[model samples]
Target: SQGEGPDPYDEILQAFKIMDTEENGFLTLADLKQICESVNLNFSNKIIQEMIEEADNTGDGKISLTEFTSIMCQTGRFKYCAPK
Candidate 1:
């Protein structure tokens, strides 16, 4: 997969899979927090909650693959979101 060139989306999805260790098609707030920590993103709990609110369009308080992908693809990065 080394020569595939610029597969940031794929990389992000793979990370999503790894983070979603429960494999339940969604991530709890706790799970998201752990992921942020594992990647050394260093976000506060409030920031994580804000991200969840922005991505969890269904108001279920969990992030599904669709929602995660939407956010990741939209931002095209994983360093957290802020108004550009």
Candidate 2:
């Protein structure tokens, strides 16, 4: 179900757009928290920190769309959520 959708790319892009606070093609820890909150998902600050460290390839304290998508695809959630 990795790519099962009318527009998986659009869905991914929209997720990134929502998470990118500065609109500079990167998502910060705050952006991650905000995105989770918007979906009513509660994640600890510790977990968020770990995710950021693990996914933020550039070590810039921000994650890019490519990195986020890679993580989501691995988690198997991208298949179900529609573009917001």
Q: Which stretches of model 2 miss by more than 4 angstroms?
A: 1-5, 77-84
lDDT of each: 0.80, 0.80
RMSD of each: 5.7, 5.8
Could you give candidate 1's per-residue lDDT for residues 1-84 as a string of tens digits? Answer: 478576556677787898897888887778888888888898998998998999998999999988887778687465333244
Q: Estimated TM-score per prediction?
A: 0.68, 0.68
Q: How close is candidate 1 to the true structure, as a TM-score?
A: 0.68
lDDT of 1 at 24: 89
